[model samples]
Target: MPGSLARFRACFERSPRTVVLFVVIVIALYVGIRDIAGDAIIETLDSHYPANEPLRDILRTARNYHRHPVEPPYKDKFWEVGQRSRNLSRWLAELNGPWGSQLRGFEKERLGTAIETTATSLFPFLSPPPPKQGSKTPLRDLQRSFTKDSRGIVIPAGGSDLQIRFAGHLIASLREVFGCSLPIQIAYAGDSDLPKERRDALLSFDKTNNTEFLDVWTVFDDATLRLRRKGWAIKAFAALASRFEHVIVLDADAVFLQSPEVLFQQRAYVENGAYLFHDRLLWQHSFEDRHEWWKDQIKEPSPAMNKSLVWTEDYAEECDSGVVVLDKSRTEIFVGLLHIAWQNTWAVRDEVSYKITYGDKETWWLGLELAGSKYEFEEHYGSIVGWEKEGSPDDKAVCSFVIAHTDEKDKLLWYNGSLLKNKLVDPNGYEVPLYWMMDGKWEKGGKKDMSCMVGETRRRLTGEEISILQHSIEAALRVDEVIASMKES
Candidate 1:
């Protein structure tokens, strides 16, 4: 090798023109390889970490032609890897039909910035004084653990009725994942919200822990805001009315798969003061209904649509409003999103205000686009474990770290839902290697063709693990009964 190198050097020295040509060829080859590798890696990350716009905007925002006003880029390899596997599922599902009732809404509601500017412009003259929201916190008992600047979690239970039913699991998971590192609160809406007994049941998760509840009407009784049906108006109210200075607005269905402490530490939150996750589905195809709800809400087109950021072919999901973390620093941005939601679509006959079914999310997306908010949660991508489908011989459900959920929050819900239909088949509880989120994608198992992300064998929880999973939900339910029986006695 040394002699060959010396000979090559001598030949190069002997012919200056030949050496220059060789150098040019080498440089060209390097650029070609670099471009290919960059594209492949980026595509992988984009397709999987569709929500990871904040992270992807590292150079794009500062230097790209299109401005990305969101958070910094994500550097976590494992998270990106896990997101990719789940993302692949999202893309595959996108290829499938929206199914039955979901087929009605195929287009996303688009609001031009010009329309929003016109609607909000009337706020001063037409709107009543914003609800009198003071810092008088309801969860004063937990004040000892939190401070004026501390962040907290807010789970909204609109008339959905599922939040309370799943309270035990949510609390248990929060405890296991967050360990009371931050204060927690529940904001419920609807005249027929939670009964006193159920509310008490939720607080019973921890004898030492106490949570705050909101009547919602106290903050969002405005006639203009009444158009919102999902009580998201209440959530919009909590964005400003809540006691905590910073809050992580979480959907009840956004069960804690793991600790979300990292969310608070993001550049969007730390630097820009605002952050939100990307919606998994965007564009006209992701919408579940065909109703043209925007016509009545605003008099004009949405001006912000022109500059809005969109998902690339690499990423599948774009915006998920279900989970968000924002501080007072970013309240303006949050409010921007709220305004659009409030002003969009007037109630049709028999329809609630905001007449739109998913007006909250639609508004949230529009508001961000209008404000050009840079902080986004999609950059910190993650997924839940479940089963998935594959071809013929490998058609059976495979227990893997899948991205599946029946909830609308799920990006690949349709696809994952279908695959998970077979269920994680394990009666006795076998020990398949655990699907490690930190490991990103699943581990390979020799050459065995498993239909999972890593393309290996399927895995299932042991009886103990299954029991534990079931127990969390059961425990919450049992506690409700225990307290009721004790009171009766």
Candidate 2:
């Protein structure tokens, strides 16, 4: 017995995994598991530990307390002693020992506390202590522990093959056209979202060989956050989950006029550690409920609340999340991400968030507000890009589908809605987009999915500006060719 105890102490010191097997074996045969399945246990540890093990499973199990469950064992009142009892039983079953019979006569309710304590001590990797409720420190610590010291572009791809095509354009623009060498991470929810073939196609976009793929499920345990299969929510989570300390989150269809690296050097981003752009300021009060909800949620108001269009102008939206930049090293930003994560969770979206805001756009700023974090939005409102209508009542009246945004200098920085002639109506005609409304008014009572411009002022692209647009269009066309090659071979 003394010899067994010594072996147990030694194995426990080496790894908690051994303690689990050692405890179970001791319970069953009153001896060491090292004597029965010693090599098997060692091999299991070798196969899984001190390497790139998929931590999602371990993390999910670790967080599986009675109060919070990855998957509830019973249909009713899941937050009870029964859950821990079930966890204890399931963990022991993996041992494939006679311990089940040993535990058969033990009172389940009485065993719950002991089982949890013993299991957590024996398998610390599989049973981490629950996070402190309503605290930013825990999330800050988690982010600090997980994040790496790097900067990169992160795009949440994978709803359909169409996203793959769009990502191809964006990646090509960054690498081939704008000449950005920053690393890129193509984040997807799971294997089903981005299959092996599509990932292989993305790998061909960057010749400098800095791009890689990240599974959102693998970034953090799904028990903590099971993202919706599709929607704007994925972008925020992708930005949060990325290994890069500083991340530029881009929509798959986003097109840039400049190398995005320049934004990192902006004074606002340098000061606040977060940067965002304004959505089209549609003058409508249709989102009173959302505003009220925000007021209730964010108790201690910050300067952002006073300056926001949501409160001041009664605008329905404030952020166009086509582009988002964040530095997770900031405790406020990391905590703000946690708030955004809760806001975008499957239940919250279906119940409140989506009904309140347009999509995931407003949640970004609102979440930051809720966490008392600071972020900077561009000084200019959203602008329009594309050609003027052939026959318009006003000479400068423009009817274009592209929603453009500007930099701090009020110059045309980038735009969403793609590079097609008319992304909504006709996609085949790739034209050199001209005419923009820097300070134009959004004509009210417009039809759905249309940007009707009413301002007499329009800014035509300079020769240099036209050249930049042309370069992005060519890069997109080149990506189309690559996709064609992929389909063929």
Candidate 3:
């Protein structure tokens, strides 16, 4: 030991610098190893391990007490859409040049807002403001109790018989999947269009006093008001503006095969005030699409397209209004959207200039485009559910297409068990089971080939539901016949 110590002392005395460098390097190497190996760990240790027994028990217990954190929803989407609106605004400003947006503003004067206002004037709901804040009225039910939070599910109806059928399917699915656990508000736009029997049948889904109807067709007058009145668009705005702290806006024709409770409790919904889906159906539009905000005041690029410095080809889009979650906390955004939608003006195109239109769908997006800078907008880029064409690509456009998108993790998009027919796809691009036609009939074993599938995998129809569906289809057929006769006359 004395000899080894003597040797080490002699080396250190000969080169103190070398010893210092060696010590520094050794310490650095240890730190490097620890940093590289530390936080990269992804999986939990095996629960069966003796050391992890306590951790395993703690985790299992936590599952029982997991309440969703109150957070803002879809910060990502709102940020992204807000950014896009900025870019679009800048691009428009650049195109307009010295005259700036002023030149482009001429189109608004020509046809857009005036046309939309005139068209919107026919409906009464949008004209009258919702009952005053903190006041009791027909629309506002302040004393109503709630189970989870005071969130309302709103389905806007277009008074189509197919809408009635789909509403039945949606309500039935909700009952089975979500246990019929929501205060659903049905905003009916056309009472005269809906038959007494069908309306009665729709009301029957609410045995638990969870369903309420807002008569949309009745044109109530507010004599005290001056300029113009509100209409159908107010249903969406009023739902958000009314007592419901949060509202899920849905199209009557859209169906939910699974429970959307997961969506409400999601980080995106809890965190943000508004949740919106991207406009997936942005294609060269036509009037038959029924989403005609573009015709109100649309911009067209000039004939000298390549040479012209200012290029305006901006057209309106059909923002998928089928599924929207509104948070009343986002007062600015909600009120802004209401104003933009109710503004009784649409975009149009003339020979010279192109202007932006304000269709219901267009107005929603426009409100976002304008308000993105002022408010937070959360846009989602996942599967969407709405009216879409299905079955053979060769067939005519399929109407009243039904689809749903649950969040990931429980993202079981299994359609019709394990059936996929002839490259059939659902509205959200997921492959769905397709039915075949044989001897002039859909071979799904129904009285008629009206539907493509018989049952859903997660929540299949019971005998009673099947009977209800059959009855609904029969009633729908009768309504169709009546419409056909009226048209022929």
Candidate 4:
């Protein structure tokens, strides 16, 4: 202990390289041991079994929500298989080194089981097996809804480049699937360069097909247009439309999973004035006391309804504009209300204006309330889900529309998967499904033969598709790394 500093200085000076090597060895040993221990813990957790009854109940409930008919007795088996497959897949993804080689086998077995279980459960829902003979009857029926003599318009608000591309993809998908010759009217609103590219893409498609592309700049005067944003412009156009039965003000990123004609059957519902929204599973807790802006407008509940003031008893439903389907009358009323609500207020962003003035969630609630309009709430299961990272459950059973919001790129995988599977109950035609790329193989069986469809259409990725996916994954990882590093820093 005597002269410890002097003694330590002497030892380091004599064996600096040896000391550095010793430190490296210790660090490596610690990391290796930690990795081993972590794997063991995860493995142990995976081995633990939950009681069967509760597990099956959860699976049965989820299945029921998607309109799938499942026998009560088989519910336990369904849950067990799903849980086991998910666990093994996750565990295998976590393993490292020589021991990790075993993961390949586990992943294949579990993934296959998961697919089989999901497919089997989904099969009955397919109704009459896919028509062996292609029926032009359905297509003809869809066409007659809107007179060939009549014209229709779809005004999508384009904000970002991704938004424009998404709108293009939706239009392309619709055209390919339906073979509908309806003259599509597209209006893109944004900065000169981005909108030009967007308009070009849409125009390119229109040139080959029969459609009209209207650039917002061409339609609007300099002063009037400058006062409004892209989203507002689209809404305004929808408000002004005269003869269109259904004026769809879709956010640029919302994609059409099924034929747009499914909406036409209910055309008269929204004809006079009806608001269509993707139904959100309202958690009473989430809306508790969250909306403050509407507090002054509505009577405050006893406990402030959890924390948001916007939660009013009048409307338990909330609408997301990502995909709004409304006829001309409803469009006129909503647009007029929105204009008056924001006229004198310091206009923040579109979503913000709604939130600040009426409490974001309550804007639609208030609009519907004031309009004295009865909304025909149609549940298009696929229309809206928060993005993957947004942690909305993969309610594939209920999803009819895949709304690509803040993150457009991730939704590409979902869209591709749906298209390739031909999952939509389209009266038109089926497109190829895309998720078979995950395992580089596919199997056939279960509902809709999604497995077979995925496998048959699966092809070795060309240099470009592989490159795009790889780049996307890497970019996402880099973003996560930056976020984590910032947190640590």
Candidate 5:
């Protein structure tokens, strides 16, 4: 032990830079390990180590603490290192040993601040590498093209004439009902997806022309990605192609009760840089293939996976992608988005993701989890908004295809079936349902595979909610009227 100490001392004396780096790593390890183990190990150490024990002994014991069962299974070694370094500043400032305790409060603060600066300075080297998607537009390249200061809404539309109509109502609700002035980008794969006339109609949604049309095929190389001219798979790729640093990707059929702009201020989105809504808790114990596929795909243990209902509750689905909020400037979110784009790319979507999950929905949260990106889902599961089946038992589910989501405050944030009773059945209809049902424990699938709310709980919208919905419906109707007029012209 003395000989080993002599060698270490000699090496440390000969190479001061190497010694400094070694100390930083050990201190960082202490900070990270302590956080996971919490006060238990600290208390244990305080009891076990005598006050007269050497500082080296205390550190060696602390280093051994990582072997405990509490170690976090973070796959990215760089991320683990960065996390360790980042926490060192606070740990050092709060250091309370004989020499450290002698430091004044201000002195400790200054020292902590310096450590923090050094830790952050190392971040460029420690940051997680962009995911290797092997796409035409790599995440690193796309990140370089990001408009860091811009924020906006992006809707992947122009898949069909019907989708164009749905997007019209969505834009109207955003501008007329919610009074949101954020620039709206209608993202399409090519001119074939959205013709000139359709582009003009979408642009007309906002009188000030705050809307712009994005041909994603032109923005991104389609040879490698093969973005379909029409499909739900285009959604994630559209978000990646968008120039905005902060983006809200809304489905063409999505209708909001409140301004989606408020989502930017949501505590979840503010902290995590990605906010997603939960899909209805359905298909439990079904889709074993999908469950197994996810298990095989996510080889690394993840905290996000632990929190997800897909794993914890064994639900087949979790995220509803109708309304997705993302801050692309964040490395984690950007990388996660890239993973989502890769998942939805032509080959992967057709061969794996689509076969496992119904559409592009499940891919959202799964990709984020796979990339270890921090994301928050709406606290509540989706609610059904439609007519309660007449003559059916009180406990029977509401017979509607609409899936509505609520915020932390339990207020209806948005619903995804559009204003019509059934958009596919009656495109021009403006009938909006009043009663929204929740706590749907049982879902009965129709021949068309549409899940009906057959649960035993129901809730009527408050007068304010109903009133706002009515105004939103009215805004949608006006958009319909304008589209009709444009067609006549």
Candidate 6:
């Protein structure tokens, strides 16, 4: 090796220019090889973490452009080489070794500026100039109203007649307990088409409550239009429904344990859009089958369309779709996207279609992203309050207030029993228990507690109440055990 080194040194000295040119070529090849290797590494990473496809693709494309200065095919002019460089710099800084430490400081300064600029383009409204510090009198004076009127109809679509009757009974119980005058309208749209008797039932329910009956026929051209068609119609309806200053759309199986007005109050902050209680689990399931489609969909910088934009949680996390609140202005945008998504859904079936266009929740998130609308997320509204496999102590905590119930009859009974036994509602038309808001457990010099309590006279338990509560608790425990076994399987 020593002799070879001496011979090579002597040859180089004799032809320095030739040696220098050869050296340049070698350096170029090394850089080219490194670049190729980096691309391969990125591709491997993407395969492992497919959920981060958009971010991964963006990084890869940016790296490619940097290694070989070529214009990308996409029209997102905002995603340029400079942005890619910033991202690469950030990624490198998050790694180990001297290169990472050296790049960290540079990334810190550049990342802030890059992120701000990128966010401005993606979310222009978020850049609105802050108002001068002053009393929030204008905001406070915006006469926001959240009244619980017992005036709406409840309609069941896919469940059995017993289920329909049970739903009706639950609605009736709520109306009686909460002094809500809203009449629930019920209907079915299973294998059989909308039958005349079902139509008559809906009409009768509507007439009795002086409210309008809404059927699948009224909402969609055809109820059995496949998944894509159904999704589109639902989106369009949600958007149109938003025109009402306060409109709610819920799945039929959901039971209302307490008034929904509480959700409305929180939704008022969303000036341009509506609030949604999203279950992270549902979001994951919605995307699990459509990983490829999602990858393609997120090639550009889309804060709204990106699932990573939201926080991730465990698989056990569940969200309830029993309730949704929408402001009128935002609904129009959702409706427009619904039409687009419906078209996409019809074009294909299976994983891609389902991931890219099916679920209303995804469309809702994407629509919000595209429209640049603000939304408030309510965790309580999406909670699985009563159906834990292990009868968690946390379940007891849920009994404090009015919850949108999603459990079966047995679980409902358990919840009722807990609420009744705990006396979460005090006498005197105020101080109702709420999981989000404790009934009367407010500190003297803190935020004022805002819950209405039922009078003491209604606190006395009747035989029917006692029996229902007991049965519900037992059934709930059994259901939990069954669920636990299923999870094990």
Clash counts for the predictions, in order: 39, 0, 33, 24, 2, 23
Residue 195 of model 3: what lDDT? 58
Model 1 lDDT per residue over 177-290, tens place: 346466677776544675676676667775448576765545444454452454555565555445676777766645443355656765556765666554322233443332
Off by over 4 Å in 6: 1-163, 166-170, 182-192, 202-208, 216-220, 227-245, 267-272, 280-319, 330-360, 379-382, 387-489
Query: Which has the higher lDDT value, candidate number 2 or candidate number 6?
Result: 2
Q: Model 1: residues >4 Å from true position, as ranges? A: 1-148, 158-161, 176-178, 227-233, 279-317, 340-359, 380-384, 388-489
Ranking by lDDT: 5, 2, 1, 3, 4, 6
Candidate 3, residue 227: lDDT: 14
Q: How well is each residue in 66-157 modelled by candidate 3, as lDDT tens digits?
A: 22211222221222223333333332333234533343344323222222232222212344334432222221122132122477787654
After superposition, the stretches of candidate 5 with alpha carbons farther than 4 Å from their true spots are 1-141, 393-397, 447-457
Q: After superposition, how far is residue 166 of candidate 4 from its true place, in Å?
A: 1.2
Every model's TM-score: 0.50, 0.70, 0.43, 0.40, 0.70, 0.41
lDDT of each: 0.42, 0.67, 0.39, 0.37, 0.69, 0.36
* lDDT: the better of candidates 2 and 5: 5
Deviation from native of the Cα of residue 271 in model 1, angstroms: 3.2
Structure candidate 2, residue pairs in collision: none
On TM-score, who's better, 4 or 5? 5
Better of 1 and 3 by TM-score: 1
